[model samples]
Target: MGKVTAGLTMSLDGFIAGPNDGPDHPLGEGGMRLFDWYTSGDTDYVVPSGGMTFKISSRAAEMLQEVFSSIGAIVTGRRTFDITNGWGGTHPIGEHVPIFVVTHSVPEGWDYEGTPFTFVTDGVESAVEQARAAAGDKNVAVSAASVIQQCLRAGLLDEVHVDLVPVLLGDGVRMFDHLGREHIELERTRIIEDPDVTHLTFRVVR
Candidate 1:
């Protein structure tokens, strides 16, 4: 069995993305600042998917390597899928790692052959189930704000990892919103400090 986890780079103000996020403005206005840490160092780290490379601190590179290697599959929202244009047919984590997109309907002209994406119109739970089945012993990473919120509300997530950036976006897409009025307890598991960002991990106290 694999643990279900949600990870994202968020601002100090608890925003995962700046306001008005869309295809044209993927990270929202000034949201790209959230990822400045990716290039704020001297160490070169190539992504597992071979899609891109990042210049980050040695510690950040180590953390990224550990995290990326542990993920076997991903479950994300349709909005995210569309924003990245399906990661140009191959996700950043690599084609070997399957991607389950929670969408209302399959997009037009999306060929299934040789593609790692799976459009799950049924719902987030079904998507998570399918992703877990594909992931096997590795972890299933749940991305996107809405999808993560759904998983948290449904009690499907086991852990949450946030790369806290030093910024305050006055208005943006909040990561911890719409999770209902109920308090969800979390046990802090790990914290890695860096000049660019702080990596925080917590186990969902179910």
Candidate 2:
């Protein structure tokens, strides 16, 4: 069994993506500023999927490496899957890790040989379950605001990691919206500070 975690870079005002986000504007207007920390340092870190690389601080690079290495599978929303164009057939985490997309219906031409994607139309719960099963001892990463919200509401998430950027986006897609009125207590577990971003981790208090 493995813990279900949700992680993403977010603005100080609690936005994950700026307003008017779409395929053409994946991160929304001016949202690219949120990722400035990725290339603001000297240490070179390559994505396991071999899709990209980043120059970050030694501490940030080491933390990212540890986190990336622990991920065995991913569960994300269809909107995110489409936003990144399915990460060009292979997720940035790695090709070996399976990705379960929570969607109402499978997209046409999405199925192909040696694909790492699996469409789950039933619900987020089913998708998370499948991801956990596939992950074995490793962690199941939940991505996208909608999917993470669903997991949080359903009590399926064990941890929340946020790369807190400095700037504040006045209007945009929020990461912690629609969670109902229930108070979800979180135990702060760790904080890794960098000049451009602050990595915060919390354990969901069940």
Question: Which prediction has the highest lDDT against the true structure?
Answer: 2
Runs in model 2 with CA error above 4 Å? none
Tens-digit lDDT track of model 2 for 72-177? 9999999899999998898889889999999999998878988899999999999999999999999999988999999999999999999999998999999999
Q: Considering every candidate listed, which one attains the maximal TM-score? A: 2
Ten contiguous residues with the weakest lDDT in model 2: 106-115
lDDT of 1 by residue, 1-206 (tens): 98999999999999998999988888999999999999998999999978799999898899889999999899999999999899888888998999999999999867778888889999999999999999999999999899999999999999999999999988889999998899999999999899879999999999
Reference-based lDDT, each prediction: 0.93, 0.94
Error of 1 at 151 (Å): 0.3
- CA lDDT of 69 in candidate 2? 94
Residue 63, model 2: lDDT of 91
Candidate 1 stretches with Cα past 4 Å from truth are: none
